[model samples]
Target: MKKIYILILSLILLSSCKEKLTEEQIIVNQNKKTIDSLTYIRHNLHPEYLKSDNSELVANEIIKNCFSVLEIDRKNLEAVKDLAHFNFEIKNYKEAVHYYTILIDLKDDLNNRYVTFYYFQRGLAKFHLQDFNGAIQDLQQYKNENTDKRTIGYSKACYYLGTCYKNINDQSNACDNFRTYAENVATDEAWNLVAGYCN
Candidate 1:
């Protein structure tokens, strides 16, 4: 009888000392809150694409998204230049000109060589738009800055300048520029065309 009484007392003590359930429940609840916060952040900050049927609308939407997120101050000038290239691919010539101008301005900040690539592209656009005088000016700039005489671009610039001058009825200047192109980067086909036509 004494051993049975002791055993019952021990069982009563053990049961009374059991931990409260609140602490365990709180940890699980806290973890759930953390997950919910993460989910909210993920949904809020993630980029969403526009649903559009038109190709041009879709392209404009993408460009808008790109402009919003682009960090111009983050030393990503090259990225800005590449965005101009993308704009050109989409046939947004005016927008391409804008971006290329911005990129050209950034060159001073980067302290790099002043590239005439933007001028060349912008000149091409102006040429297509029949802004022959503007095209001629930009092509001249391209030519003046060109240090290498052997480059394909140099030859092209010379030929374009000749064409522009010819359009303006300055035959002497046109002949001179075309002759320079022929002498310098003269591959047979391009040179022959320039020589035969400009002469």
Candidate 2:
């Protein structure tokens, strides 16, 4: 009788452990399915294909699907960034700012380079939305963190920072950044800023 009671207790403990493992496995499988669906959408939905009238509807549907996935899994960085870029391409600057803000808030897990890109893009979106001071803060953060002054991003940040300052009537800082941008990049836009504001 004693031996039987001990055996029954051991079996009960084993069964409880197995139930816990099954619950964990179910959660893992659900997460995997969500990730897999997101991956499929990302692979199939190129923003370039959205330009044509014929494909615009399909592209919008794909964007909706991406949004759905993002709603469920907010930490999916690639999908978030893709959505941000897509919004920016479509001239939805406010939406781009929203998505980029999400990415910016995830500072702990992201690389510095990616964080800088987020700041740059978000700053551009904010500028388009007429939030000049917000734009300046993000653009300045990118400039301070990014070491490579030769990249197009650096020049663009400088140009925009200069423009933001000019808009706010800060000619001194405006000319300073615009001059730096002109010295490094010779784009038509940069030259226009130099002629119009920096001079």
Candidate 3:
């Protein structure tokens, strides 16, 4: 009788201890909040794709933050990628290539999609440096590794391949790639290249 009573008491205690579920609660504020420095920097990085006005002091501050983050965590991939992009945005192609090379070399838990883009970015940097052979290699590798064929990136890659070939005076390959770009994106520039290069 005593054991039965104790077992019943334990069952009641366990049931009482069970957690109760509650509905999610959300709070909304109508006031406009002040923009922080990082937010401002990120916003500015877009629009023009960071193609201009990036040599200013405010832009340098973001680069400094990326470096500061890396100082604490050397293998921080986001910081490394940000550094690469910031340098590129500022037209510091040499530094962009350096950091992008590091990004390519560093191992991470992320899917390879971002890594593939690093190759494309590095290729563009090499192109800016007029290293046509190196740019061709990187851009080709990116094209091969990428699984999605219909994105804007693929179109840009095709366009760049044609430009690279044109730069090197490889007329046949330039015609082939420009036609490919024209068929997919149908941009005025691509059509012009096809007309000018491909008979």
Best by TM-score: 2
Candidate 1 local lDDT, 54-73, one digit each (tens): 54554454455445335322
Clashing pairs in 3: none
Ranking by TM-score: 2, 3, 1
Error of 2 at 158 (Å): 0.9
lDDT winner between 2 and 3, please give it. 2
lDDT to native, each model = 0.66, 0.84, 0.76
Best by lDDT: 2
Cα-based TM-score, every candidate:
0.58, 0.76, 0.71
Q: What is the lDDT of residue 55 in candidate 1?
A: 45
RMSD in Å for all candidates? 14.8, 3.7, 10.5
RMSD in angstroms between candidate 2 and the native structure over all alpha carbons: 3.7
Give, for candidate 1, the lowest lDDT window spanning 10 residues.
41-50
Pick the winner on TM-score between candidates 1 and 2.
2
